[model samples]
Target: MISVLFFVLLGAMLGAALGYASQVFKVESNPLVEQIEALMPGGQCGQCGEAGCRQAAEAMVRGALSPAGCPLGGANLTQQVAELLGVSVTIADADIQWVATIDESLCSGCGRCYKACPFDAIVGATKQMHTVIRDVCTGCKLCTQVCPQQCLTTVALPPDSRSWFWPKPQTAAA
Candidate 1:
């Protein structure tokens, strides 16, 4: 009973020390970086020349990158990010929206496209018809390159009423 009591006390003491240390060494994230990241598209496509949106946000906060760095987010997101960062920015043309389409007749159900898709937008089983989840697809084109049957193709998505947004204003030549 005495040994059990001693062990309990020792455990409690260590727990208390750990809790105190955690409180004393708490790390706070920069709100600016969080805001910038929130404004990003979260595509993780590396189109911004960074590994991911969080890294891009950190770079933007550190003045090593610009708000226009993300092509996937386009001019609208750049404008929003620029406003949040208190910086003037020129908007670039929005990227063409693309969606993958799998020709069922040509699809061998090899599952290559499914395995290559980073977003899991392609859904099918081996020896079955694979279909592209258009809504979930980021149109990264990873599926097209990996399809052994060459059945996958990417096409520009026509904007519907719900998908349409105001076009960016064109600037005059300096």
Candidate 2:
């Protein structure tokens, strides 16, 4: 009983010290980086030339990267980032985003594409046909590149409820 009481007292003291240290050593972070990271799609697919969304957000805040850099977020995200940074941007006609699709007829139940997906967006068991989870896919084309049977292909993601945006109002020519 005496040993148990001693251990409990030690644990309590250590916990208190840890709590105090955390408060004293708290690290400050840029609010703009946090906000930009929040606006990202959180795919972490490395398609934007950064290792992850947080790194990309830091780059954006540093002015080393453009707001239109994220392909996964598409035009809507570009507009949001531009607005946040107080910059004007034009969404190019070539800014179309693509998503991977498996041609069911060509699929041989191989799992290569599933293994290649960094986002875990492809699902299937070994020797079973794999399917792409549309919402989670970042269209990095990694799966398409690694498919042994060439069953995976990329197609333009059509505008849906979540992705659809209102077009900028047209102005008459001066």
Candidate 3:
């Protein structure tokens, strides 16, 4: 009985300490919801199936919506947000692949395009011919504008790199 009583007291003390620590270190919450609402493209494009980005973000917190609903947020930003929410997310079916293609023949290897790529998909040393690693490319088009020689081109996703998952077919009619 003494041992049990001692254990219970210790557990209560630990719980109280943790609760106090949490109150002391508590962080401001819902920053993403507010920020996303503010950053919304405001085209009022209800691509997220919600009335707008604000509604979609609320639904996301409620676990009733997917981040894919926000047409303006895109997959990259949405994925980062979903990670914070501890929720599963749907990948956006974005425009067909737009990987940056550098023409080695024309590439001056100035490294501007590599610096412009947001996904770090391009790699090379200074004065060395930089190449885009197609798989990692997010195709935000930032690199195309920065290429000094104007050698960048976006290509459609190859048949193989492209993913196609068919919806489950309905059973035969009775």
The digit string of per-residue lDDT tens for model 2 on 42-116 reads 867888999999999999888899999888888888989989888888877566667899998899887888888
Taking all chains together, each candidate's TM-score versus the true structure is 0.76, 0.87, 0.49
Where in model 3 is the C-alpha error above 4 Å?
A: 1-25, 28-66, 69-95, 167-174
Report the candidate with higher lDDT, 2 versus 3: 2
How far does residue 90 in candidate 2 sit from its true spot (Å)? 1.3
lDDT of 1: 0.83
lDDT of each residue in 58-135, candidate 1, tens digit only: 999888888878765655677788898899975434446788999999998999998887678889999999999988
**Full-model lDDT for every candidate:** 0.83, 0.87, 0.69
Candidate 2 Cα errors over 4 Å, as ranges:
160-174
Q: So what's the TM-score on candidate 2? A: 0.87
lDDT of 2 at 98: 79
Best-fitting candidate, scored by lDDT:
2
Question: Please, what are the lDDT tens digits per residue for candidate 3 over residues 43-75?
Answer: 444556787667877777777876555543555
